[model samples]
Target: MKKIIFVDSTQIGLFTFQAYILELCNLNVGFGIYIETFDIPLVLFEKDASDVVRLSIDESLVQFIANKSISSRIERQQYFNQLLEFVKSSEELAAKIVFKEKEMEYLADSKYLVQMRNIYINSGNQA
Candidate 1:
């Protein structure tokens, strides 16, 4: 398993540092979840290893990905490619890109599901 650190802006204030632990669920695509406090995952490609792939998760699939298993590496790559194409091809999605949140089922039913959900629900503060 890979450990990625994320700095949550909402959690940072005055002088409080808290480490919220999140569990990894088998996406089954060989790709593990690298999400932090934020819903989006910072996907780094194998090529340059510097390029970050941003995923625009669909709302309908949020709970599904949260409840499903992970996927393989190749499957992840394919899914990523497909998402990229989807975003590029859809004018409605592309227009409101910044307003959408990304969601996937890779780390769905992990041991930390409850905790993760709690944190997300409490910290999200979204309408």
Candidate 2:
């Protein structure tokens, strides 16, 4: 049996995520993970066992479904269909989550905002 993992790239703290994914692909590890990117079909990899361990990622969607050894092609197709429906329904929610994360990153990286935050903290203590 194989394993699968999901990674949301729209979120921060993923600096080494791409490198990690490539490493897994190069090493032909049975474990697989998928990450969503702004691009279509964001990232891809192959497994040695010919397992249908495929990944599909996009701006608001990150999904990876490893075909079970016991399952038939039709079953795999059903899994893909379900995943597509889930992505379609969750687009709005995913977009909101990604946007909020980016907004937080923007605020955290702003030196001016940091200085202002520090000033506010200091002034409150002086009261």
Per-prediction TM-score, please?
Answer: 0.23, 0.26
- The candidate 1 region of ten consecutive residues with least summed lDDT is 9-18
Tens-digit lDDT string for candidate 1 (1-127) = 2334332211111112212122334321112122334343322211112322222223323343323325444443444344333323332332233123323222222333344333333332232
Worst-scoring 10-residue span by lDDT in model 2:
12-21
Task: Mark the regions of model 2 whose C-alpha exceeds 4 Å error after superposition.
Answer: 1-64, 67-69, 100-127
Task: Give the Å error, residue 7, model 2.
Answer: 14
Model 2 residue pairs with clashes:
none
Could you give candidate 2's per-residue lDDT for residues 47-122 as a string of tens digits? 3344433332332222212311233445444433444344333333332432222212121233433343232223
For residue 94, give model 1's deviation from the true position in Å: 6.8
- Pick the TM-score winner: 2
Candidate 2, position 4, lDDT: 37
Name the lDDT value of residue 32 in candidate 1.
Answer: 17
